[model samples]
Target: MIFHGMTVRQKALDLLDSGANGADVARRLNVPRGTVSYWLHMERSKRNICPGTRTPSCHRCDGVGLAGADYVYLLGLYLGDGHISQPTQHRVPSMMITLDDCWPGIQDEAGAAIHKVFPDNATCRVRKPGCRNIKVYSKHLLCLFPQHGPRRKHEREIALEVWQQELVDANPWPFVRGLVHSDGCRIINWTTRMVGGVRKRYEYPRYWFTNVSDDIRQLYTDTLDKLGIKWTHCTRAGKEYNISVARRASVALMDAHVGPKY
Candidate 1:
């Protein structure tokens, strides 16, 4: 490896590599016979004659990239021994993961379904008393669920929200349903608005719950009082606030009112 330390020899060797013969190198350097040969042999050997060394990250031969040996060495580099840290739970790479690839418990459930439909294939085709259509098309039943490819980000967001909505709707209690609906719907207070840009009193004017039903409103009020929600109840009867300010105040009231029903 000390052969790497000799700049002149290395240069000569490089020139040699670029089709410069031994005689050409000898002629250029004006060296006698066998001196270049000795240098070449010294390069081939692993003796540490020079102080410095070429610490190339290779397990195979140095100073010369031999045919296919270099390739094997490269392969060793490619397939390294470095260990990867495992996650606390099973972790999948994101890119290759489609909906089908990451279908939470789908595969096992599908397999069970398949097995249920098609128990012991040998007996089933003989048309026993319990030979249902499922038994006839066992393979078809096994592969019944179609392969759903990767949904894009927007699709996934929509799917998740839809799933959540479905879950909420499926709940037995009316209060829970109202709470879920409230979560989805925006709040609006009964407030006044200037009619057609005129500098006068707002056309629509009142203070009532926007989205919530009567029972929901009552429930909200009761929950808020229990949770000590500082809601903006009318201390003054005829107080006029700007539209934006009123909307914000309404939101605050709603937040305090709908503290944490879920």
Candidate 2:
């Protein structure tokens, strides 16, 4: 009756079959109990089968939509609490990353496994001996390694030693290393960043400027206007400015907040 579109009564009668009980089957199959009874009544009268309501399953998500929308999340863990530098934090042990920082080529096999399996919006609570909860944005479900770095074994020596030496070397004046710190007291260092998209086998320098520069002069003037850094630029004594987190920004993620480096 359903296929041939013969009669409504016949279609209804056929809904109940096999060992299925009338009431339970009616509710499970989303048909009214009265309808199931009526169909049976009509079926007894006409002695035929009946069809029932039709429903389509969600093919896209296969019903996983009950949980959340499809997406990936990245969580950053720090060695110490980041709150000492910033006010409060949300979603402890996690920092949010914007989508643009991720590219398809970035994920490794291990990272892809998490992205494919972990539930969207599922929390990653970092609870390790030295773990710190510091979240950052990652569109590709990956955390950026600390660029303020000494955390990584290989870069431990280089981040502090080489970067410090480079920045001090950039200056014309001889400056003591240990005494050097930004106005906020974060250690002074050079940060290198390679320019993107060029086929050259070389990369550009990416480090903090520990010395005077025309760009930094403009920046100090601009920032001083806002933060009221009391000072005067003199042609006689010389131009010097404190490098501090309260002063300026850097291109490096960790150092981005570690500048006024003039």
- Report, for every candidate in turn, its global Cα lDDT versus the true structure: 0.31, 0.31
Model 2 RMSD to the real structure?
Answer: 22.6
TM-score for all models, in order of appearance: 0.17, 0.16
Model 2 lDDT per residue over 23-109, tens place: 865676566777667666555445321112112112122332311111111111111112112223531123322111122222231
Per lDDT, the best of the predicted structures is 1
Error of 2 at 82 (Å): 12
Error of 1 at 206 (Å): 11
Q: In model 1, how large is the Cα lDDT of residue 14?
A: 71
C-alpha RMSD by candidate, in order: 28.0, 22.6
* Candidate 1 lDDT, 198-218, residue by residue in tens: 645433212232221233233
Runs in model 1 lying further than 4 Å from the true structure: 1-184, 187-217, 228-250, 253-262
